[model samples]
Target: MPEILIAALSPVGHFGPLLNVARGLVDRGERVTVLSGAAHEREIRSVGATPATLPPQGDLDLDLLEPDSGREEISGIKRLNFDIVRLFVAPMPHQAKALAELLTQKRFDAILADYGFFGVLPFVLGERSARPPVLLFSTTPLMISSRDTAPAGLGLPPSTSTFGRLRNRALTLLSQKVLLRPAHKAANCQLHRFNSPELPTFLLDVGVLADRLIVPTVPEFDYPRSDLPANTRYVGMVHPSPTMRFRPPVWWQKLDGDRPVVHVTQGTVDNSDPRRLLQPTIEALADENVMVVATTGGPHVSELGFPIPHNAYVADYLPHDLLLPKVDVMVTNGGYGGVQRALSTGVPLVVAGNTEDKPEVAARVAWSGAGIDLRTGDPTAKAIRAAVREVLGDGRYLRRARELEAAYAQRDGVAEIAALIDEVIGERAVAP
Candidate 1:
C-alpha cells in the first residue's frame, strides 16, 4: 500500500478540515498517518488514519496565549500578530523535527499538510529531492499576499481599479514591513535554525513554495487574484465524514412550522462569552416571527445565564449538515467552515465577527452577496434584528446562496482531493 503523511496544528479549526482529508485518503486505500495533537488521536484513528502526536513544544493551548494581565489593552490586530508568531511561526523548529523524524522511519508517497503547519516549511524550503511532495491546504481564507487585495487579516475586499490597486499596494507594503514584520522575522529565524533558505515572500504567502497549495473553497467565495500562483488548486470544500450522524434536539419539530428558521452560532472556539453574538441574536429575534435555533457550540444552555425566549431553542450543537438545510438565515461569528457549510446548503447569513480569520470570512459572506456583514464582533440587538429582517425580506441573498449551493453540489471535493494526491504521487514516481 502507498503510504501518505498528514500534518496539522492542534487547533480544531486547523485539524478538523484536515481530518476529513485523511478520511478521504483512507477511503481511497492510502495508508494514512496523521500528525496532530494528542487530544485528536482517537478522532484521527476513527477516520482510519494512524495518529502521531505532535511534540510537546508544537502542541500548545492557543487560548492560554492570551495575555491575562492587560488583555483589554491590546488591540485586536496586535493580538492577532502575537498569535501568528506564537501559535504558528514560533513552533516551526519542533514541527519540522517531528515531521523529519517520521520521514526517516519510512518513505511516504506524499504529505498533505494544513497550511498553518509551519513544520513542513523547512523541508519545502530546502531541496525538492530531500523530501516527498508536500501539499498544503488552506483551512481559513487564503492569506497569500496579492496585488488585487489588502493583506489577509485586514478583511479588505478585492479592488481592480487604479486607486484601489494603489491602496492595496500601500497596505501590502506596510503589512509586510511593519505590521507583520515580527512574524516574518521569526519565520526566517526558524528557517535559519533548520539550515533552510529564508522565504521569498511574506510568511503567510509561503504556500506558494509548496509543491501544491490546495484551497478547498470555490472561487466565488474568495477574492479574485490575477497573480495567484499556478501551483494553487481549488478543490472546493472537503465534505465532513459521511458517517457523522445527527441526533436533533427535542424542539427540532419547531423547524417545520410556518415561521422562518434562523440559526445562530458563535462557533466552538470563541463561545466563552454568550454576549458576543448569541445573546444579541436571541434578544434581536425574540419578538420576531422567526423560530430561533441557537447552538452553544460546547457550553450548556444554562451557561447562557438568561431566560430563553418562547420563540427560541438552544442546544450544545446541532450539526450544520442537519440544521442548515432547515435554516433560512444564519447569524454567526464568521468561522470559515460554518459559513461555507451554511452556503453549501443554500442558507443565507448575518455575519458579525472580527477575531482571528472571522473578519475575512464575514467580508466574503457580504462580498458574495449571500448575506450581510455587520462588521462587529459584538453586534447590538438592534443591529442583529435589522440584519436578520433585511436578509429574510430580501430575495437576492437566498439567490446567491442557492447559486453557491448549486456550485457546491456540482463537485465532490473529497474525491477530487484524493485524485489530486494521486496526480502528485504519480508525477513524483515519473520524475528522473
Candidate 2:
C-alpha cells in the first residue's frame, strides 16, 4: 500500500471532492493524509483519514471560501486579478515552504494536488530529484487555454472560424497582461525562494507543467478541444462531498407538485448575502406558478430576514444529490460543483456570476445550450425571471442538459482515478 499525501486548495469546492477522493484512496488500501486549511481538518477526519494543515495566510485561509464581507466593492477584471494575487499568489511562499517541509518529513509514495494548489510548484518543478510523482485533478472545468479553446477568465464561447480564432488569441494575450500579470510577478517573487525562474504566464502554462491533468466533466459537456495532451484525461463528475450530510426540508413534497420547481443558490462562498442569487430568484419566481427552494450555504433559514413567499422553502445546506433530480431549473452563481451537479441531473440552469472562474463556467453553460447566462455578478429579479422563462420555454436547453445527464450516468470517475494512481505508482516502482 502506498502512503499518499493529497494537497487541496482550502475551499469547500476544492476540499469537498478531494476529501471524498481521499476516502477512496483509503478504501483502496492506501494510507492517506489530506493537507489543506485548518477549517477542513474535521472534514478530512470524518472520511477516516489523517489531516495536515496548510500554512495559514492569516487567522484563516483567504480563498474564495471566505465570506464576502465586502465583495461587492470589488469589480472589473483588474479587481479579479488583484483578488487572486491577494488570496493565492501572495501566500505562495509560505505554502510552498510548509509543503516542502511536510514532503521531506513524510515518506509518501505519491502526491495528489488540486489544480488550485499552486504552492506545489516548488516541490514538483524546482531542482529537486527526490520528489514523488504528481497527479493533478480539477473539481471545476479546466481553466487552461488551448489552441482549440479561448483563454480562461474572458467568458468567451468557442470558435472555429479564422476571425474567432484570432479573437481568442487576442483575449488570451489581453487576459495574461490585464488579469494575470500582477499575480505572475508576485508568484515569481515567491518562486525565487525556491530558486525557480519566473513564468511568462499562468493559465495555459500550468497545463504544460503537469503531465497528467484530470478534468471532472465529460468531453461533450465541455467546449471541444482537439489538442488535449494524451495525459490530459477526462474523468466523470466529482460528486459533492459525501461526508456532508443533508436533511430534506419538511415541504420536500412540493417538488412533486404541479408547479415547476427551481433551486436557487449562491453556492458556499459567495452565499454570504442571499440576495445575490437566492433572494432575487425567489422574488422573481414567487408570484409566478413555481416553487422556489433556496439554500443559505450554512446560515439559518431565518437569517434571510425577508417576507417568505408562501410557495418558497429555505435551508442551510441541502444535498445536491437529493435536490437536483427533482429540480426543474437551477438558478445559481455558477460554482463549479453546483453547476455540474445540476447539469448531471438533467436540470438546465440560469447562471449569473462574474468573479474568479464563474464567468468561464457561465460561458460554457451558455455555449452548451444547457442554460442562459445573465453575465453579471449581481443579477436583477427581472433578469433572473426573464432568463428562467427563456430556458423553461425553450425545450432545447433541457434537451441538451439531458444529454449531459446520460453521459454523467455512464460513470462516477472514482474507479478511473484509482486506476490512474495505480499505474503511476506501478510505473514508478519499476523505473531504474
lDDT of each: 0.88, 0.80
How accurate locally is residue 14 in candidate 2, as Cα lDDT from 0 to 100? 79
Model 2 TM-score, all chains together: 0.92
**So what's the TM-score on candidate 1?**
0.97
Model 2 stretches with alpha carbons more than 4 Å out? 58-60, 63-74, 200-204, 241-247
User: Which candidate has the highest TM-score of all?
Assistant: 1
- Give each prediction's root-mean-square deviation over alpha carbons: 1.4, 2.5
Residues 120-238 of candidate 2: C-alpha lDDT, one tens digit per residue: 77766754346777888876678777666688777888886888888877877777776677777777777787787666446435755654688888887788866666678787886
Candidate 1, 182: how far from true, in Å? Answer: 0.8
Sliding window of 10 residues with minimal summed lDDT for model 2: 58-67
Best by lDDT: 1
Q: Per-prediction TM-score, please?
A: 0.97, 0.92
